[model samples]
Target: MGIDFLHKAYVRPSTYTTCIILTFMDQITYYGGLFFMTWATFERHLIIFHSAVFNTKRGRILFHYLPILSIFVYITLYYISVDFFYPCENHFNYLAFWCGFICYMNLPIPTLLGIELIAHQVVPMILIGIFSLALFLRVIFSRQRLRQSIEWKKYRRMIIQLLSTSTIYLIFTTPFSLNPIAQAVGLPPMFTTPVYAKVSTYWTFGVPICVPFVILLSLPKVKEKFKPLLKICGLGRVVPTR
Candidate 1:
């Protein structure tokens, strides 16, 4: 009965569109997660530092600014993704200009090819490695401070929740980042060699499904929280409001 209700609810076109948009947005954000991570980490630091100085007004301003900044960043990344990373069928691949020239013109190609290979493969790997290490250190330091503070008990669960979210994000994204690197270096297919590409894809897409469930399960007041509103609508009898 519950399954049928959910099936009917999800059958709406708007619902399906929302799901599609969410999937696309999630994937794009995963691709851009490294950039978002940098900004998010910086925002965390700013909030921590300004906790005392930035009263409700300034703190509210900062809170608003972070989402705006993130949206702008995402838009910029969308431009890069559409224009540069994955050019359209009619678009020229300027990134491949040199490679094409060398391969076709046969003009002293080895050095140019090597340079292209390194630029495409080696540089990104190095950057991601450094960024991940920096993020790990930042998280560790922040966690240690939280542990030492008097509010440790109050914040402990929240800290764990954030860490779990970060872990899920990393699990979803790390493979996508590394997959191209491995392929570029001529490594055997991740799937055929005991590691499966489909598995990575599944895990990446699974994050969106998993995150909401995790939040819903962890948070208290699942029933009382919405019961009053549902009762007002005559959807069902109201349980006592918490």
Candidate 2:
């Protein structure tokens, strides 16, 4: 999209190649992140509120490995079916943020608005909020349970991890996702199009760029990795080997 900004590729012609790359990347990062993060939020709930779900090998496979595998397979198939093999012909705007999902516009309004907009995008977004809030509530209530004497340290780490990562979704990605959905539901492009165009430059790919950094920053191991680098640069004192 940097190239798009340099020269309005979204609105320009002969940009099919750029469009394909951007569309593929945008869907994989945005949509793929939605599912991956939603599952991560739910898994945190299980880890904190129902630790026994991971106590056994079977439990780990069922609750952990299987879902991850399922998401990978599902995301792969879903995008390939929708973007690659769908009856619609390619109409790339390589300079655009997603290189255009205009092909989706070719579908019946019901299928496009209902299935693509509602099922794929909205459901996952709703699940994100629900799971996040549900986990928080579970954390609060579990504190009073004798059986759930899970350490505050564990709870604290999980809480911070979720909150920190979710910050990107709230501030950056939500608008990006909502703009299209709102437009689909009859929100005038006259109102949203200009604002989104300006905002999309910063917000379009920013979440994907920032999220991994945020997640890494929330992790203790990432901090440890930084300390060594900092020390070598004379920015911090070295830690003695334990």
Candidate 3:
């Protein structure tokens, strides 16, 4: 959220350094999310469909932490390359609000954009979709002896919610994902005017708001734990009757 704020305030000349910092943070945040989501999809697949393997320390470290660290290192290197070639530039056109103040790279537009679209958007989306579908099938085909059990139902609900959230994230981001292809191919840029940029930017912000809310809502145990706290603050009250 702080990065989002800095991104919004990039119009200020005094905040040029802040904007640059925010740009790096933005790259980290964007790719970090892609990597994490990819890891999460695979993790859930393991936990649900292959618990024996997922439960091991070696498996956890290998599948979980290693991928996260690799993503951080890879994105750090990629951004370093980007900075070496085309340092961040603050642009304040009428489209700045939508287009953002940080201009990443101008020279290697096609090559870099192609790489980003594939790596950050296309590949991650495909992997997530595949793993999520695998999980869905696992839930469907698993033995039904315990289908009525509370734990089994809980896992089923969580899987359904996970699929829903992943679908939403993909749908919301598709436009932003494809928008760069236009510029890469010499078509009119996606954000020609502030009006267009303003309209398109909403997709980018959707995940930040929707994902947390969905997670909280999807977890019954979490909501149950929060009930007491909300009641203490008069936020969740139950009247007593004689």
Using TM-score as the measure, name the better of candidate 1 and candidate 3. Answer: 3
Compose the digit string of candidate 1's lDDT tens values, residues 47-83. 4433453567766666656665775676556544643
TM-score of each: 0.47, 0.75, 0.71
Top TM-score model: 2
Q: How many backbone clashes does candidate 3 have?
A: 0
For candidate 3, write residues 30-147 as lDDT tens digits.
Answer: 7678778877888886666566775789987887788888888988887767744565554534324323544554435566656777778767877888888887777777747546
Q: Give the TM-score of candidate 2.
A: 0.75
lDDT of 2 by residue, 38-146 (tens): 8998899788768898999999999999999998888778776776667778765554545545586556556743466566566777788888888777767777784
Q: What is the TM-score of candidate 1?
A: 0.47
The lDDT per prediction is 0.47, 0.71, 0.67
Best by lDDT: 2
Ranking by lDDT: 2, 3, 1
Clash number by candidate, in order: 1, 2, 0
Instruction: Score residue 68 of candidate 1 by CA lDDT.
Output: 57
